[model samples]
Target: MKIAVIGTGNVGGALARKWARAGHRVTLGVRNTTEFKGKELLDEKNISVAEIEEAVKKSDVILIAAVPQATADIVKLMGNVSGKVIIDAMNSVRTKPDGFNNSFEALKALATSAEIVKCFNSVGFNVMADTNFNETIADMYTAGTSERAKEVAKQLSIDAGFENCYNFGGDDKVALLEQFALSWINLAMMQGQGREMIFKLIKR
Candidate 1:
């Protein structure tokens, strides 16, 4: 899959490396091609950097890990995303997009032509970097109105070494998924569980 990753932060950087290692063509989209947060990612095979618009234009999927408040501006810079899959990996726990409750809501209004899904926001970047814990691997969760987008996210999750990508229903569950991420934050940070914790589902 040809994927464009916006925001070169820890989350984006980790995923880019993982996907590249998994044989996916990962493009790091940024405002400046020469200098960015994860410039070292360029050394990885199947990973390259490009300006935001160019990267978005060429990729089939776009993973947005940018700051919440920058959601609107980033979508605007993406140009026409018609028939594209947009995986929103941002959370509004700290700040939200201007005039929207969260990044997903903002994308719903602005990037209407794209299939949007909320994913890769439930865990910390370190957890994303390495999902394995002894013999068990971590699971991922996603929520969105578009089944197509959700499937895309699921495969990407697997590519990134997650054990599974569980669906959290549809668009209505989007906010709920963000809250679930807050639950992880509350435990890992607020409750002093540290960052090594992982969310998993077990059934008989």
Candidate 2:
């Protein structure tokens, strides 16, 4: 799988390294090319770094790890990214009192000819990279309309070293954002435990 991971932040960096290690041809899409020069994990895992359009044009999956507000613009930049799967891993957290209607932008981005899946936005970079706990590793939850998109999400999760992943299903639901935020806040509150902890829903 040729994957393009935009945004050089923790999320993108982690995913880029993981997939590249998994033997996929991975390209990193960056706002600034110079920011990626010193990543030891990148080249070690056979990852190539490129500008936004180049990455999107040459990959099987385009993982949008940019700031939430920047998503649509990148989608426009990659105009007609049809027949490719788009995995959105952005988190929309506004400092302002009135929060953004986050799902609206994701829906708009899906306007591009692409299969969209909202995922990898729930957990921290540590968990995403190597999730191993006392019992079992964490599960990566994914929500997407297309079955193929969900399958890609699950495959990506497994390739990234997760023992389990759940396809939570559907497309562009506002409820997903609410669930993400609520989980994020709770995870944030667990200090000392730090960002390594993950939310794993289990049933008896």
Candidate 3:
């Protein structure tokens, strides 16, 4: 799969590396080609850097891990995204997009041509970097109305080393998913429980 990562921060960098190692073509979309948050990612095999518009044009899927407030601007830069899947990994914890409560809402409204889903926002970037704990891989959760987008997100989560990507339901559950991410943030950062811990589901 050719994936365009809109943000080269910790979360974006970690997932890019994982997918590159998994044999996927990962293009890092950045405002500046020479300097970005995760410039080192260019060293990884199957990973390269491109200007935002070009990157989006070359990829079939897009993973947005940018700041919540920058959602509108980012979507504007992504040319035409019809028939493409967009996986939003951003959360509105500290701030939100201009006219929306969360990144997912902003993307849904602005990136009208794309299939959007929310995933990879509930866990820390460290957890994303290494999903294994005592030989058990962590589980990921996603929510969106587009089944196509959800399926793409699930496969990308698996490519990033997660054990499974659970569907948390449809578009209405998007806000709830962000709240779930807040719960993880509260536990890991506020409660001092550490970022190494992760979430998984078990059934009989």
CA RMSD of each candidate after superposition: 0.6, 3.0, 0.7
Per-candidate TM-score against the hidden true structure:
0.99, 0.85, 0.98
Q: Write the per-residue lDDT of candidate 3 for residues 163-201, one digit (tens) a residue.
A: 999999999999999999998999989999988887678
lDDT of 1 by residue, 39-139 (tens): 99999989998999999998999999999999989988999899999999999988988899999999999999999999999999999999998979999
**After TM-score superposition, what is the CA distance of residue 80 in candidate 2 from its true location, in Å?**
3.1
State which candidate has the highest lDDT.
Answer: 1
Whole-structure CA lDDT of model 1: 0.95
| Candidate 1 collision pairs | none
Residue 97 of model 3, lDDT score = 94
True lDDT of residue 38, candidate 3: 95
**Candidate 1: worst 10 consecutive residues by lDDT?**
91-100
Reference-based lDDT, residue 70, model 3: 96
lDDT against the true structure, each candidate: 0.95, 0.73, 0.94
Give the worst 10-residue stretch by lDDT in candidate 3: 193-202
